[model samples]
Target: MSAVGLTYLTLILIAYGVSSCSSKEKTQRSLKIAGLSLWRLLPLLAAVFGLVGLFQVFLPPELIEKTLGESSGVASLLLGGGMGAVAIGPPAAAFPLAGTLLSAGAWPPAIAAFIVSWVSVGVVTLPFEAGVFGMRYALVRNGIAFGAALLIGLLMGLVL
Candidate 1:
């Protein structure tokens, strides 16, 4: 487990100990409900982690380098956007992926764009985003994010 996971476990243990010592039925009931909520959330979290692991295993660094490496032009931008589209994991997964890409010779601009759009503009999450924030809002946000990612990538390529 990660350090954050361990820390959360420790905190939960401490809370459980204190709650159990209190001998209050209401508190116990509340704790049970909270535990159930955590249990329900666990599966989704596990799936996300599993997907991240799968991506790391299947999409090797060399493939990313071959596709997006040192290409300064429209092709590089499109490659970056496509890479961003495919990457659906959290920051934890993205960091390792970015490092691997860098080691495999992917340009900084492309990697930066990929990382930014990977997090900021998610097609997978679009339905939920649209539901919560309206379709127009979601569309505009994604469009701007995609454009910004390209601009940032191009600027980084020029500067670095």
Candidate 2:
């Protein structure tokens, strides 16, 4: 780990140790909850990182730069937003991928749109959302999310 990361880990460990000493039962309960949450999220975490590895290998940086570069303009926004909406997994995956895109010459607006839409929009989860919240609600929410993402991308491009 980096020095900063090691320092943070040390601090967290010290704090956790102190907390456990102060209240054993509470600490145990908290640990149990944390463990359960970790277990629940492990599969998703694995899948996302695995996908990221594949993405890094399969998608040429040249393609990303060409399609999502600053000069790509509105097309970049649309493509990024559309890709974000369709792509599944988590914000964890999006952030790293966005960084990669940015380093490869993608504009800030496109990257921002991608991250926002990836977190908020969910075309892949539509069926589940509809099953729980109704089809119309899901569709409307996704549509609004998409529209707002584009607008945010436009404004960001102008401001930044």
Candidate 3:
């Protein structure tokens, strides 16, 4: 296992131990909830991976480099951020796609923007968000996320 995986496992075990000691019933309930959530997520995970595989197979590396390469600069970041904002699926799914893009010669800053906006701004969920929170609030929040995504990409470009 990777160091990060081992660390996560150790932390999880420690938390489970403490929780079980404090209240076995509650620990069991928590575990059941987690299992159910994982079960529900399995189909989505499978679909996302399948799509990613297809993307890798069909999308040319040269095309990716041409559109999102380091030379594309600010335009690449903007394009990546826009695509991410409209992307559907969990943040977990985006990570693999971002990794694929990175390995295929997409600019690091573009990938960074993609990840940031994919996790933060959700155009697909905007209506629901607006319904729960006021439309104005949702718009403002998304706007902020979009701007922050671009800013983060810019900083990443400078640093990396």
The best candidate by TM-score is 3
lDDT of each: 0.78, 0.85, 0.92
Q: Could you tell me which 10 consecutive residues in candidate 2 have the lowest summed lDDT? A: 47-56
List model 3 lDDT by residue over 57-137, tens digit each.
999999999899988888889999999999977788898888888998999989999999998999999999999998999
> Each candidate's TM vs. the true structure?
0.60, 0.77, 0.89
Residue 42 error for model 2, in Å? 4.5
Estimate, for each residue in 1-160, the C-alpha lDDT of model 2 and write its tens digit.
6999999989978988999999999888988998998888788878777766776788887788789987888899889999899988658667777877787778889888888888789988999999999999999999999989888988987898
Cand. 3 Cα-lDDT: 0.92
lDDT of 3 at 47: 85
Q: Please list the residue runs of candidate 2 whose C-alpha ends up more than 4 Å from where it truly belongs after superposition.
A: 14-23, 39-59
Clashing pairs in 1: none
Selected candidate, larger lDDT, 1 vs 2: 2
Question: Could you tell me which 10 consecutive residues in candidate 3 have the lowest summed lDDT?
Answer: 88-97
RMSD of each: 5.6, 2.9, 1.7
Instruction: Identify the leading candidate in terms of lDDT.
Output: 3
